[model samples]
Target: MSMNKEGRPTAAGAVTAIRTAALLPDEPLLFEIGDREHSGVDLPEVEIGEDRLGGFGRRTSLDLAGLTEPEAMRHYVRLSRLNMSIDAGMYPLGSCTMKHNPRLNERMARLPGFADVHPLQPVSTVQGALAVMQQLSDWLMTLTNTAAVALSPKAGAHGELLGMMAIKAAQEARGEGHRRVVLVPESAHGTNPATAAFLGYSVRSIDARADGTVDVEAVKAALGPDVAGIMLTNPNTCGLFEPQVIEIADAVHAAGGFFYCDGANFNAIMGVVRPGDLGIDAMHINLHKTFSTPHGGGGPGAGPVVLSEALAPFAPLPFLRRNGDGLELVEHVEGEALGRITAFHGQMGMYVRALTYMLSHGGDGLAQAAKDAVLNANYIKARLEGTFSAPFGGQPCMHEVLFDDSFLEGTGVTTLDFAKALIDEGFHPMTMYFPLVVHGAMLIEPTESESLQTLDRFCDVMLELASAARAGDAERFTAAPHAAPRRRLDETRAARQPVLKWEEAEGRAEAAE
Candidate 1:
């Protein structure tokens, strides 16, 4: 409706226009933009007279849309640009440890000998690859000061399962298989409880103390003949090292229960501390997190479980062992082993990359990486001390800092709101509402990857946002990410009304928009 002479507002529901410059442009799905008959490259047509699939054959069209080579290249390149990657900037995703993955690791991982070897190749033929695995295991064993390392768990959660399985196997060997409970701390990684439950162990929650560390007395009270083990994370989700961890470990041992340390926070203490020294029975070290391989894409990860002497015998199969002249892959489960957790001998690319990081850093360098990680996190805590609310304030944190939404209480701003606004300021949001213990948790882990200048810039932006929220600038946050490649989304609605297929409502892809 055009404005009248009075220039009063009309019934026109005209939406405010967003500038194209502020948008990352809609990238149509291949199914939406490509022709089904189009081919990126021409090929000679060869018609098969006989069906090799026996009775099984394609009865319907695949309905795959094809694009030209340039179009396909451009599509992926556009998608990559829209991503928030560590290589693009500092990724301070607490607990996840989004630190810099050195290019040296990548180059080593891509070497012909490491990258080209197949798992099924003859043991003699893949000596170099096997040597890489052996070197990585040796480094992990040395770093953690553990008895053995299971190098085939594939990822962190898988490694957790392996660790617990080893615990169960050891218990059963000692005729104590009746143990059926796994104590999980509230501040531990969520996977701890899930892994315990998945393995048929009843999960008992041990509450965190006022300071965010696990309650030791709670562990003692929960201990019994039925207790299998306690899963704990040192330098826990709250980013504070458990000062009473040794006491907790001893108590659990006295009660005939093993201790499984969630090594997710190992980045903070890799060189300075060792889990074996703390009496940990089994722990899974994420090669991607501590040793610095490219992390978090749902693929190409390694979580080799370091085992104590008690649990070492039960370590999983497909591990590397020295065979006099060369390294050998123990493909079959021997003694009290947990058998095979994965189909192959683990992620080879991750092994090479992790080893490269170790060789490049050496012992002292790895320790300093841990030190710098803690320093960076503490730096963040110090900078945002009064501005943002630290859940466990006035204490030096590990590799990450935990902040709550208390500062935004009266400002009508939320943790999520503040995070969305951060995106507009050219940064990926910190991990929010996690560890569940804190009300509106914002966990930031700068790792050792970030420079001093980057941390200062990030702190400046955080302070400005905090000040704005306190000044009753709720609209600024509520309507945030106004200048991001995309805009804020109603995540709940998207989850509830998910359009999984490309054929669904034509514009469903733009639901976030």
Candidate 2:
């Protein structure tokens, strides 16, 4: 509410408010703010002549721009201030697991030896770095209860490729290369099918039951002698653990097929359940997610894969081995090993950070973290299940809660509008319209990093927004994000004709130089 200079409160969704950002106001692009002729350093002018430039001689003045030291620094600082990070507030993105990155891990990752050591440095001088990798591998193997771990793959997708490659190699070595089909559940990550197809294997989709889980009978029906394996996410995208995962794995093995599990949701049951115990042949553990390394923004990811005894011999090369009281990096492919995945062993900084996180929180602490994560998600579900529509009833979730837009069917407010309106209340919207199994899906994961007070505030705002939508406040939902720097955009037009460059975004007034 605002006064109109008459000492009277205005109405809700009125035009009395202004759409200006409190921070980073009027921040322009580098081209818009820089001068075409200014510079921070003196440069000798180049002479332009036909002898020097030949057919590439200049026809028009080049619009090369420059900025002073202070201007360049402040421009980036302003843009950095506009970003929304997990450190700033609650980040409820579900399947991605955007949680807090501990500062202590950062401090350890920046230590002199760990930060400055080269991948090709002398093995004797960099024994500590190699030791870090070995220790991380040991922890991963112990937690997942697998026979071996390959730490060279870069990220989750890369690790999937490694796991699938191992499965393929194991089948070929035993003369079962005729298997060509890979079964992938719809609830699994999209990368699961892509990785299988990239490896020249046929992808077959498996159906999910009404409770948002895979049925063991469905897996049994899909299995055959030509089937290679099954790629499944245990705690699926619907935020419910696949109750028949063990049975599915056993059935797949009965048909001479491998089991590859996508470990993206290992954050939900890291210390509580082991994938190997469920008859999984190969699984990739996302160090960036479950182990608390840097995630998002093109950050480095370490996805070390754990292998069962059946597939351990086909693990990737560049593994560490003990050679009479000294550690040796086995770079050569010996008998049946898969070739190297990368030029080096793995991401060193990511290994350091993940190990630091593990050491800081012992076994009990990690188990508690998993429990608290599930607890927080269930708490949010219990609070919002009545206001919103949960596709899967009121059952307890793993580490996230999934909701659909059934509550706003006749209210004229869509799931997108509700998400956009959430921006007005100072919170990042939950992951929306995902998993593709439910209509207008909204998945929220409040990692154990959040406090009860923060959860209450988020829930209160959510309830208030639900109430507003139910009351037919169409204007509020339609024209939302009133407090952000920019207004709602023409999403369809933007996607069809994207402005990739600054000049293109501003309707370029200057011609090509």
Candidate 3:
């Protein structure tokens, strides 16, 4: 690989325009320094005639790049600086709650009891860890007011699959396995329909009302005996709460169906609304989103699905248990419990972090966090409504505010252009063109963590962009993000023609240069 002038890896195939090197000391592909007799570390003395790999290996030379220790360290350190991480600044991506992850939680997660435990350790030796699990479960039960919880799911989408599996198992046990239609609101998260459909259920979309909330009558009309369930997201993708959630749940249950609430938005209503009391049969709580756990690279998330009394019996197995004086985890063959979803206990690190966040923020603090999340969104809405167009302007939203491109009609600025322009203003862009119900949707969620001053500054930048759009400055909008580390890219081409590998060859650097 050749270091392009822009400091990115350059290859020969599908080459773009060549430019003079802008970044200094641009290195060539690592293969350029490979040698037959070079090695970085000393190897121990061993017999060369030993039959390793059963004589099926060593097809070619194990050539690798050689570099000094300092060069390697500096290379990685410089690359790390190029990344935009939550540790660097505020991450304002909507629908993804990126909040402040306390350093205390990190410290707790790294403790030997949590970080050094093996998945296959003896249950007796790991009783303390199991107790941690049990305690977390008790808190989850108390917080959601639910009967039971299954803690094996890996993430929000994986948890949705588990909730649907429980519903299916319950239906099969009742000899009503033919029910296969899942009613999903149009404004629900995209994964809701995909999860239901993947489980062989027909997805029927229900259009939201003009106010961005689900219409109770529409849901009632859609209910039938074949309905498996209704998957909905309260404080929906449009950031509006479905006030008729209880009625919708009742209608679905009356029709012999369960209610699967996508709890990804739980951060906006935690400790304020207990989903169990709201008639929800099952819901998944994204621990990473609401509890300030570090969201790894799209993974290592814990989504524990809480079940109502009616559905608790069908929860997954291998849950934590507490005896009179000791703690234990039930992982063996049990009676009629759904089998384990993961190989061992769920992500212990995430659990510890989530618990630490919850214990630090008691009941009132959580409620206030919910309240502040809503207040911040409304503040943004109120500040930007005059400049931008709100699709549903009359009522207050929950945690995020949705804007469409109606105000830019004659000015010709699109939602994508406006979002790209935010990158130039030293902020990550909001979610754009999602929730497909609203045209040119821009969903911005400023969690409870943002200060009033920061929010005002963001609003000022948004207003300036809105003014530019209103003044028909479409050229400036189209070529946006001029101040970012990189300029605007052809996203469509990048997605369609993905370059996913690196191979070593000669003349790669010269051709790229």
Pick the lDDT winner: 2
Which of the two candidates, 2 or 3, achieves a greater TM-score against the reference? 3
TM-score of every candidate relative to the true structure: 0.92, 0.89, 0.90
Name the top TM-score candidate: 1
Taken over the whole model, the C-alpha lDDT of each candidate is 0.85, 0.86, 0.82
In model 3, what lDDT does residue 312 have?
90
Once superposed on the true structure, which residue ranges of model 3 sit more than 4 Å away at CA?
1-53, 62-73, 335-337, 505-511
Residue by residue across 265-344, what tens digits does model 3's lDDT show?
98889889888888888899898888888787623889989999888988887867667778777777656747988887
Local error of candidate 1 at residue 468 (angstroms): 0.7
- Please identify model 1 stretches exceeding 4 Å from their true place: 1-23, 42-57, 333-336, 504-513
Clash pairs, candidate 2, are: none
Residues 278-300, candidate 1: write the lDDT tens digits: 99999999988987887767238
Model 2 agreement with the true structure over 1-513: per-residue lDDT tens digits: 222333333322212121236555556666665545544444456885547665687797566545555556777777767777787788898887877899998899899999999988888888898889999998898889999999988999999999999999999999999999999998999899999999999999998889899999999999999999999998999999999888998999999999999999998998899888998898998888888887866369888999999998999888899878778898886474578899888899999998998889987888889999999999999999999899999578999999999999999998899999988887888999988889999999888889999999999999999999999898899999787666787899999999786664343344221
